[model samples]
Target: MAQLSDDCFAFGGPMMSVDDAVGLIAARVSAVQERESISLHEADGRILANDIAAPLPLPPFTNSAVDGYAVRGSDLPLQAEAVFPVTGRVQAGGSAQAPLQAGHAMRIFTGAPMPVGADTVFMQEDVRLDGNGRVVVPAGLRPGANVRPAGEDVAAGHPALKAGQRLRPQDVALLAAFGLPHVDVRRRIRVAVFSTGNELVSPGDRRGDAQLFDSNRFMLGALLARLGCEVSDLGIIGDDRAALAGSLEQVGRSHDLILTSGGVSTGEEDHVKAAVERAGTLVLWRMAIKPGRPVAMGIIGGTPLVGLPGNPVASFVTFVHVVRPTVLALSGAAQEPLLPMPLRAAFTYKKKIARREYVRVNLRQAPDGVLEATKFPREGAGLLSSLVDTDGLVELGEEVTRVELGQTVGFLSYASLM
Candidate 1:
């Protein structure tokens, strides 16, 4: 396996700035080129690796938007109670009858192809049926009503989806509308997860020797899986240099990405960062963002590696803000916008201009359809309950030193949490 220069990770007054770290990572990274084709039913949550165009128009025909009577718009007499014979019938997915001659109407249903020469539809509710099976039309009916023209929903050969687009349920439905049974998507990366600390014990195991439960492993693992990565849970690695290096070597060989928690901080027992530097580059990134100030990024062998803080909340925040973008980039996704919907603040807060801050907050709709924000009671980096209690994050920019009451701020949707 490949490794970095022995002294590449040597200390130099903290590693890289947040902006600089992201730049370095992005500079060294590119999406994998491999593609995986799957059926539409299985493509949800997958990222498109190639451009997808409509094989055909969504409707594929001029159809009715409602169940009504189809007729020649001018045939309906301009006067009250104009009547016409029901020439034929059209149902959804059914062929049209013989073209309507002038002064004739046809019974139609929603999604049915509009018969030729039928320029308009008078809704059943708008017309009264006469004893002769003909229908009376209201005055002032327009030329075309309730007609869904062919290619109206989706144009033939239009770009139905773009490469790097993440497929959602609606996207799958769009594919089905094009008669596509399969989709082409980027191959999901296999990420191997592990943690290193003799002081850590797995869940269900009794703790001893200044030990704590290994929560970050499971948390990060689940997050990676939800992002559509195939994850290999390597559990925990004890703090022996050989064992740590061995585990890293194994993961680097088998996985496209290797993620580890803890051991990046400087302490006698914290050798994760040292081992990474010995085996590969482990650049520490002291971000401008708070509660997740300590972030590490570098390449391990041919695989990318991220080292997050041991604090659960710090790990989560760092993963979302810093690591999530990198993962999405490597997975060939169109980058998501960072700006959230601007919201009015319900509380006041202050911060240093040099450092960015992410405040966990809950949102409630006000009487006038505006969103009000409330901060969590506690704001510690290790308090997992803060994440559980809050709806989403309020990002305070690096320049703004203080925010006053009721000032408008950007609020990210909690619906974004996954």
Candidate 2:
């Protein structure tokens, strides 16, 4: 569990920008200290707990890079092709056995160790065998052209993988190359997810006349799972403030975070704000952003809680900006900000100044081979299909009031968001 102080996220100011909110979280939130050792196969997506230093140089020794002949740099031809007698032969997994005699070339295959006196290599394709069985070499070939020196890739005792890195497949490969069968990684964060409001019902449950099946809980669970979280589905709580507060307090004891959607706004029916205030500290922030404006952040029983909007699209967008970073910070993972891809705007749009907006867009290649972004036709934060049909979001900065056609805009692909 995260041992956070009650006033960890205390901000009493007016509406803040998206960058300000994220910066606050990065500055305040602390990572969980619990860690465990796991096999290399289970290390992907887990946060590394320690830096791994290379025990030996990569490649470990000087060796041939191709099926070629190894010779002394002094023996290399000065201007014309030179012929030298083949002194010895070496293949991959074979030793040099003896040094190459001066003016002689050694027939060495790829990965074969270089002989004591050899400092240059000539690819077999670049050289031919003379009628007298000597190896023919071309002129102007640079010395050390095909030679890979020791510690060329990574030196011994240098940092290969740093602490706080979220291990990917390639990172796992590096661990294997270092002959490590297991690694130490931070434990997966435990999140308790639930939705508020009486109008929501669990999917597959008998629905009431005015109730709709809950979708945000499942979506949040899936997003948390992608971040390697252990999610606990707490089901939907009703509009009653007492019951909601009780549940939040109880669940906060065991989980690292409590995430809920709906009831975050200031409506009379909205109870999450009051419930969290009753349970612990609550900082209701009015983020200066579209789709997700009313974001409730609080701490309960030493655990952090984030109350997102009821609308699916708003919840999704805020999750990307809010919960995602909080999770990364808690797991002690490195801060990897998502960079937007630039594309030409194929449609015109307008927005208010000083508020960042993410417009759903479909991307396609124009006849000229440049990527163009077309906005989704519908306009509503409640439209789930708008998120489904679009490829990604076109981010409009706080200062830009309008976007003209053919203008270049930054695009955030859905595939890269997680």
Candidate 3:
């Protein structure tokens, strides 16, 4: 593991905007230097550590794009249908016996390498076969039609994949096409996640009258897993400053990031603020965002720590805005911003100005065939059903204060949150 500076994230400000908070994380954090080579089967979702250049052109040679009749461009009929003897045949994984003779055609299948002298092809459906084993050629067939040229997809020595790229399934297929069996990727980020509150207990534990089961820890674990992090579940901790401080210091030694939900607010029982201060440094960020206002960021023993709100909905929202970017930075992955889809609103809503808000909503196509968003009936941050029942969230900007029915709004789907 690579160590970060103790005061790397030491900055303070009053009520930061969502964009400002994310920008600060991107600017300050650095990626871990350790990298390892893994097989292509295990490369998906991993960050590429080095650039990969194409060793040879895709397809490797000029081939037929369709199962058709291959012929030289010069032999194409000028104004009337002509006939040519089918003297040769070629199928995928096979080659023509010799270069195509003038005024003759070769029966070729898709993916079959074209004969040296042939530069055009006529689809088998378009051309008919005569009674005497000759193919009827059509007039006005353009040169180089229905034939794929070498290097058409990717040229040799060109970049096939760049460093810091998060490899998707398609990206893996591309690497396989280039005959690469293994790839160098950055190691998964190690993250320590836990929940803090005296009134909380693990799901399997017997619950007391005043205690509830911990859900934030499980939710955060799933979110971190989606980001390809090696999660260390620290379970729930009681509201004691000494115990919290000791836990933070111990986890900070091995983990890249320490994350907790609850006990971050300025309430009487909120011990996270003081506990983090004792371990290292703490910067309480009053984010200008609804339902997720109090977010704590600190550095403990050269590792970063983030404390989020207690509400399940708030934890989910802030994770997308704050923790996602931090994980990407630590992995040296390219930052891909989430672009919201535009849709019409089916309900009226209002929010305070200067604070960004996300409203849970279900999307449906209106009678007229346009997609519209309907806000969830309940607005409580503690309701987990709001996230599960809705399709996604309707993001209201910091400047917009009111939304009218049928107005244009930005919709972000739950699938894209990661």
Candidate 2 wrongly placed segments (more than 4 Å): 130-133
Judged by lDDT relative to the true structure, which candidate is superior, 2 or 3?
3
Cα deviation of 98, candidate 2, in Å:
1.3
lDDT of 2: 0.92
Global lDDT of model 3: 0.93
lDDT of 3 by residue, 140-234 (tens): 99999999999999999989899999999999999999999999999999999999998999998999999999999999999999888999999
Candidate 3 weakest lDDT stretch, 10 residues? 1-10
- Clash totals, every prediction: 0, 0, 0
Ranking by lDDT: 3, 2, 1
> Which run of 10 residues does model 2 get worst, by summed lDDT?
6-15
lDDT of 2 by residue, 1-418 (tens): 8878888788778788989888888888889999999999999999999999998887788989888999999888988999999988998898877889999999998888888999899999999998786989999888887988888888999899999999999999988877899999999999999999899999999999999999999999999998999999999999999999999899999999899999999899999999999999899988988889989999998899999999999999999989999999988998779899999999999999999999999999999999999999998888999989999999999999999999999999987888
TM-score per prediction, in order, is 0.93, 0.94, 0.97
- Candidates sorted by TM-score, best first: 3, 2, 1
Q: Point to the candidate with the largest lDDT.
A: 3
Pairs in steric clash, model 2: none
